[model samples]
Target chain A: MTRFAFTVEFDGRPFMGWQRQAHGPSVQQAIEDAIASVTSEAVAVHAAGRTDAGVHGIAMRAHADIAKEIAPFRLMEALNARLRPDPVAILACEAVADDWHARFSCTGRSYVYRIVNRRAPLTWENGLAWRVIQPLDAAAMHGAAQVLVGLHDFTTFRSVHCQSASPVKTLDRLSVEREGDRVSIHAAARSFLHHQVRSMVGCLAMVGMGRWSADDLRAALEARDRAALALNAPPDGLYFVRATYPGES
Target chain B: MTRFAFTVEFDGRPFMGWQRQAHGPSVQQAIEDAIASVTSEAVAVHAAGRTDAGVHGIAMRAHADIAKEIAPFRLMEALNARLRPDPVAILACEAVADDWHARFSCTGRSYVYRIVNRRAPLTWENGLAWRVIQPLDAAAMHGAAQVLVGLHDFTTFRSVHCQSASPVKTLDRLSVEREGDRVSIHAAARSFLHHQVRSMVGCLAMVGMGRWSADDLRAALEARDRAALALNAPPDGLYFVRATYPGES
Candidate 1:
């Protein structure tokens, strides 16, 4: 058996989410079907992160097992050819050792959220951005976001349905930057609980809209209760950007 | 009768074009419907530029006549309220002299064309940008673009159906800039022949991909024939960004 890893890109608007559900289509099911079409092998692919509905992925990492002996790049080409009209593409493929699990081997993950702050309706970026008609204070949001950039019990930000064993996760980076009418929030960590990024963005938005102060965010972190945090931002604005692995620069 | 001049924004995917058409919906018809809904006035709105199918307008200026005395800002709000699911909006409105014409009073027009140069398929910016898989040479394209940025008879780039009385128009600016994966072509002029922006982008794209040289562009322009240029790029990636009028800030 050969273990192969793949980097994927997808527009998640059509799928229910990354995971398979009884209701609708999923990103994993699409890849699994494509793998079967190319290699005639039914393999369960493991992704580095399982994104939610309407959330996009730029370079998602996944791993699968196949019995056939094929070149890595050729496998990518075959899979992409079969995955037509789905808005998903296999960016790159590589052979890896059996011990390299897509989820377990990932050391860090990064995500970006886009916000279009303008009075006019979004033309080209209608579904891709979170539109905020009023002006936002990006500097204040950035200053408030810095307070959550360390090891802490992120109980207030974790989703109620999150399956993580513990709420204590080390957040390595959290930054916000503004360019013209767009504001981007970038977050990185070893791993994050489900809906954590969206939850934090909700709080940051409060600071941006002058509804909450920096001290309020710090207080929410210290409270360690979900009710102390703001509502989760919409999934349409979120993106699972990429994942990092050891010795894989 | 009172005349009002207004700035508008719209997502052009749903409309046939800026002009009112009998077969399908259009930006002009949408605004006209909204204006009649607001003031019970049967109005005909004239735009600064009549864009083609799938062309977006960021700040399209238009003028309409109303029988009732309505506040400019209130007229803007009323029209926008009626244009809700269609994604058309009136950004600003002001009462102007009855002689003011949106198409003739404009002193300058500016446009932007977006090109996404990358290998992966566009997820967030699918319809908003022109995705070119190969890497682009922005400097080369810019060098070639400067050759057309002055007073000239642009017959080589004019559309066959263009209604301009003369092909001679002064181009004030034609610049290309690259930021990461996005290559933007900006053009400014007092007036332009139809399809000028799309035709220029098609020529610039060839120079950007190293398929055509600077001298090739000069030869095409010198040919003074429409067929001398390459294919006209799609109208979906074109945006009429703004128009400047005399004594307006």
Candidate 2:
């Protein structure tokens, strides 16, 4: 048996989440089914992060083991073919060391949240972005986000359903940038709590709208209480952008 | 009655094209229906250009006459509310002179055709780009495209269904640019014969793939016959990007 790692991309509109569920379709179930169709072996696909429903993935890292021998490129092509009509794609695949793990591999993860700040409604990007009708001050949002960078107790920014053992985690990077009517919030860390990025972004948006101040954001973090959270942005604009592993670029 | 000019945008995947069709749904019909729902008066909406099936519009200029008295902003908001569930939006709207015609008063038009030159199948961008599996040398395509710039009798590129009085027209700009796997071909002209941009792009792609030589392209243009046309690109990747007019930036 050999372990294979894959770079997967998917539009999350039709998916319930990244994990397998009995309620509805998930990205993991789709990949697992595709692998079964290709290799005749039911393999469990493990993703680096489990995204929420309606959360898109640009280059989500994942891995699975198979008894059948197949070239990496051929496996990727076959998986993509089998995953057709489901908006999931296997971009690249490579055989990995038997000890390598997609979830436990020591690495980093990055996410991006897209917001279309415009008076006009979205057309082609309807399900892909969050539209904020009020004018936003991106610079203010950026300033407020700086307070969340570095290690801290992020309970106020985490989901109640988070499975993490601790409420405190290191936030390596958090920044907000804007271009015209679109605002993008980029966050990176070794890992993150459930809904952490979306929660932080929601509070920052309030600051951008002149409803909250940077001090208010800092106080919310210090409160370390879930009720202190200002808002938890929807998963529509959230995207699992990238994941890094050892010895890889 | 006042003439209202609109800047429109839409995803072409769900519609037949930009114009009202007898058989299928269209962007024009969607807008006209929305306007009628708002004003309770049936009006004819005209566009700067009529796009083919599966062609998108980024900022297509169009105009219509509304007999009902309403503010331009109110009309735009109402139209958007009525256009819900459709992949169409009005980005901007304003009252214009009665003589300001969308088709006749236009000074220039621009289009961009997107080609994903990669081996991997598209997922999120499935219907938004034309996938070319072959490796494309974009520089070669750009060099070959320059030959078609300026005035020429583009009979080979003109569609048989084109109603233009003359196949002779001036191509203001034709350039090919590449960003990683995405290759965009931008074309501008005072006006274009039907299928001219798609036809030119198809041949340029042939040159890009090393299937046709630059000399062959010149020969095709020189032939001035529809029989010389090499290929007609699918409309899936084509987008009507801009329509320039007097006093508009």
Candidate 3:
């Protein structure tokens, strides 16, 4: 069987996150269904990361094994045609070694949180971004985010449902910037605990609003208790930007 | 009655167009319904220009006269609350003189057409941008766009349903810009005949694809016959960007 690595992009409004679920439609199921339609085999697609509902994926890395002899470009085209009417697309596909795994072999992950810093209700960006009526001091948020950019116990910022055995993870980058009226937060790490990015962003937004200080953010991180979390940002503004593998740009 | 002018924004995917229709939903109807729900009046709202179905508006200028004495802020808030679940928003609102008309008093209009020059199907930007599979020469398109800037009889680009008194109009600007994979065509003029922007964009795209040349585009324009037009771009990529008025920045 030839293993194919696919770069997937999807709108998270309709799917129940990235993984397959019995209760509702998921991005994984949609891609697997499309692959099945193409190969007639019940193939399971694996993703680099699992996103929450309403979270967008710009270049999510995924893989599936198929015995059918189809070119990567043709497979991408065929999958795109089958995924039609659904807000999902197979951006790129390439043959990979059978040993390559989408999730286990991933080395780094990046995410961005978009905030429309305006009081006016969203129109075209309704579900794509989070609307914040209060003006945000992006500089302050950026300064405060620096404290979370090293190895630490992120238990307070992790999800209650997170399955990671240890909340200790090394965060590579956390920066906030504002352009025009939109504030964006960028985070990168080797691996992120469930809801870690969103939780950190929520506390940083508090800092931006002058409700919490950088000291508070540091104190919360030291607490190591989920109850110490100031807030958990909604899934609407989150986006999976990229997944990097070894020796790849 | 007090005249309140609004800067509206909406995703045109759900609407038939900007104007009220006997059948299908319209942005005008959605705003009107919200206003009636707020003030209990069947008020008539006028827009700077009417867009075709699936054409978006970023800061569309419109106005309505209401007998109720309500602050612009309150009116905007009410309308937003009432227009909820619909992909429309009141970005700005202000009191205008009774003499000001959204359509007649507008001095200039701006439109932008977005083309995603890629083979991958759109995900988050579905219904928001037009995707072109062929590689486009944006610089060539931009060079060719300058020829249509001067005053000319644009009969070749005017729609059959256009009700303008004359086809002769001066195009102040028609510039094509490309940032990465997105090619944007910006057009500005005092007024435009129906389908003028889309038709011009369609022909420009043909020029960009090397199917047509700058000379061909000029020949079609000089022919002054609608039959000579190369193509008509779909409404999906068209956006009513802004409406300029006298004494406005």
Candidate 1 TM-score, true structure as reference: 0.93
DockQ of each model against the real complex?
A: 0.44, 0.79, 0.76
* TM-score winner, 1 or 3: 3
Sorted by TM-score, highest first, which candidate order results?
Answer: 2, 3, 1
Instruction: Look at candidate 2 and give me any clashing residue pairs.
Output: none
Error of 2 at B60 (Å): 1.0
Worst 10 residues of 2 chain A by lDDT: A119-128
Writing each residue's lDDT as its tens digit, candidate 3 over B1-249 gives 999999999999999999999999999999999999999999999999999999999989999999999999999999999998888899899999999999999999999999999898998898898899999999999999998998999999999999999999999999999998899999999999999999999999999999999999999999999999999999999999999999999
True contacts kept of 2: 0.80
Quote the positional error of residue B65 for candidate 3 in Å: 1.4
* Pairs in clash, predicted candidate 3: none
lDDT of 2 by residue, A1-249 (tens): 999999898999899999999999999999999999999998999999999999999999999999999999999899988998899988789999999999999489999999999877887787788898888899999988999999999999989999999988888888889997899999999999999999998999899999999999999999999999988888989999999989888
**Model 1, which residues run further than 4 Å from truth?**
B97-99
- Sorted by lDDT, highest first, which candidate order results? 3, 2, 1
Model 1 lDDT, full chain set: 0.90
Regions of model 2 farther than 4 Å from truth: none
Q: Against the hidden true structure, what lDDT does model 2 obtain? A: 0.93
Which digits, one per residue and each the tens of the lDDT, describe model 3 over residues A1-249? 899999998999998899899999999999999999999989989999999988999899999999999999999999999999899998889999998999999999999999999878888787899898988999999999999999999999999899999999999999999998899999999999999989999999899999999999999999999999988998889999999998787
